[model samples]
Target: MLSDTHPAGPGAAMRSDEDFVRAQTGIAPVPFVPEVRLHMAEDAIALWETTETARGERGLPPPFWAFAWAGGVGVARYVLDHPELVAGRSVLDLAAGSGLVGIAAALRGARSVRAAEIDAYAVAAIGVNAAANGVRVDAAVEDLLDGDGGPAEVVLAGDVFYERAMAARFLPFLLRARARGAVVIVGDPGRAYLPRERFAALAAYEVPVVADLEDAALKTTTVWELAGD
Candidate 1:
């Protein structure tokens, strides 16, 4: 759901990404992962409309960073509970919307954490959220899908299988990362394109979510480790 189109025109220039994010959201603790707090939007539709008005563009992608997705919640919870997985290790949070998973890793003693996102606004939100959590996350706008997953010892992806094109691209990248000996983990709510057979379930959680965004107040999300080379 990354968009190449950034905010433009005078209106967009006047309002910084951080300013827009703060103006549109309120800081609150995620229901399933209360140990972490985020700048979240109360209404998805309202925020989308506001973003459109500010950018003077229509059909822009939804603000995925404005909510703590069920998959991310599950992954963050699992990471916090099992600190050994990331402790003293480098972690790459791929397509990190709000950088929730990366922040959790940092809090759990990850040696280093890098959060990748293609959306500029999302990158800004990640920085803001990381600071709020008293963690340092190297948030950047980069698409790592085309290459082997960097030098990180661990790779984390959450809710990435929702779209067919994305899923197609993501699976290969994750497999390549796993092939390179990086522990690849994914959190998903059984999205349509998830290659379930390729992963082994490690943990599951009933993650509370925004009903309007996910169509369910709570999602049965699962954390899975990529299996096989």
Candidate 2:
């Protein structure tokens, strides 16, 4: 199981729009700003882009991906570095936070892309951002581990190894997908649950992340990828 020192408790599960907003801008770290390009998915759920001021002290802020989380950065870097991997394949982006990876796949010419996420707000955010980017993707509010996934030639997972419960639920599914002849790729930056032996390193990058939400601009995060065992 994965483990982390980050607290998880009441009001922990993004309960309010304010919480979402606070997450986006109140904690701006000095972003490393990679040159990775993205292609938005049209069929993905769409949510308005919200900023600290635009939220007006109410409504939800954008999701983690909107600001480009660590995992997203790593995946984006991989796609930009190796565009040919997705040029003509069907892709499944699991735990599709902000739908960035999936969008990248579509942008790179994937025949089809699906962004699967369980959070309604995240799903909506993905749809909105996907439209903004002008790509086509199917968005579904389902967990692949819950037996809700469909067949795809490739699967993308980003930063999902932070929580033990999540890792437990997700790893087996990824292994299963691998056994089924699908390419399973995960971008992680030393998350506790990442099974080093089960994957082969593909790439690495230094991504900026908020070390302290209150202090925002003081941290640099390292990100990496595991393409296969």
Candidate 3:
């Protein structure tokens, strides 16, 4: 998930978002979804510091776009395995950090894919990562939580329930999308704020993740479909 801050920082004038992301990360295969590759950071703390230094700012959010979170990994794996869910459909990847899930949708033959992120750096990472995977994903820096989830037939959200405030807003947005006939899906690693009662579990997987980031080497992530009221 992303923070409310949107500034690219003062130093952003010197280096482009794509260039900063490339400089801080290395292209690598996702642990659980090896079929797709992404620009990943080697050290989370170091990269976070680097991003802050480059932006000439402190107290910025960590580089979430530089790692494949377990929730996102599980969602990407499910989409690739069950291509029927997104095949020939327009997909919206909400809070699409690293564009992992959206890229998977494209690889599985989604007619169109759009990855939405509030952070400009994440948007740039999405573009570069999609290109690395040989897929076309339109990445935009925008917050969609306030709107009826756009015009996509399939809506994918990963790791979005980790925060209380974000979860409050996101759950209603997802419910609105589902009510409007959009197929809404979410991938979560048992975050405290996830309203489990609002969704039905569709699939589960033991997703491998960076120990430094998740505290555990593996997370039991589940892919869920929003249930009707």
Model 2 alpha-carbon drift over 4 Å, by segment: 1-66, 213-229
lDDT of each: 0.90, 0.62, 0.90
lDDT against true structure, model 1: 0.90
Candidate 2 global lDDT: 0.62
Error of 3 at 202 (Å): 0.7
Q: How well does candidate 1 match the true structure in TM-score terms?
A: 0.93
Q: Distance (Å) between predicted and true CA of 125, model 2? A: 1.0
Q: What's the TM-score of every candidate structure?
A: 0.93, 0.69, 0.93
Candidate 1: clashing residue pairs, number: 0
Evaluate residue 136 in candidate 2 and report its C-alpha lDDT on the 0 to 100 scale: 83
